[model samples]
Target: MTSYTLGQKYISPTKPERGVFPLDHEGECKETMLKYMLCLSRNDNKPSLCQAESKDYFQCRMDRNLMKKHEWEDLGYSNEQQRKT
Candidate 1:
């Protein structure tokens, strides 16, 4: 389940193909939905950590890696690490 920080609250994912609109972000909802949809459209399957909130908003962020896979490998948290542990 999505988590929330003190300032930011959860705005559930929506049909992102519709495009990002100002109304959609009123009061600081999840703006990443739009970004995520756009990224998918670009064929960028690489996941990303995204967030949306006003100065008074708060929310937790997901883990996103660059298209490059070396970071996790260096940290020993690679997908293989999960399987091995």
Candidate 2:
């Protein structure tokens, strides 16, 4: 007796063509990913104040391994220090 379909729509058969901070690593963190995409093009776009330039472009793509080293609380982040004493 297992009926679970609250909104049945799930898709994740590992179709990950690389993109969590991947602008193809933007030629190795191009100026901190252009200041986190210019703080997401301003206009009061406060994405948590651009989480310290999005944790310095995901720690420069995990130091050139190109990804896979996550723990700013599993990327939900709280302190990677862009600015917020």
Question: Residue-wise lDDT of candidate 1 within 1-85, one digit each (tens)?
Answer: 9776889868998764422223432323345555555555565554432111111121112122111223434433457544543
Candidate 2 lDDT trough over 10 residues, lowest sum: 17-26
Measured against the true structure, the TM-scores of the candidates, in listed sequence, are 0.22, 0.31
Q: Could you tell me which residue pairs clash in candidate 2?
A: none
Candidate 2 off by > 4 Å: 1-27, 35-37, 40-47, 52-56, 63-70, 74-85
C-alpha RMSD by candidate, in order: 17.1, 13.7
Number of backbone-clashing residue pairs for each candidate, in the order shown: 4, 0
Query: 1-85, model 2: which lDDT tens digit per residue?
Result: 9998899899777656535434563487778878888997883777677777778878887888777887766667655452362
Quote the lDDT for 46 in model 1: 41
Once fitted onto the true fold, the runs of candidate 1 whose alpha carbons sit more than 4 angstroms away are 1-29, 44-85
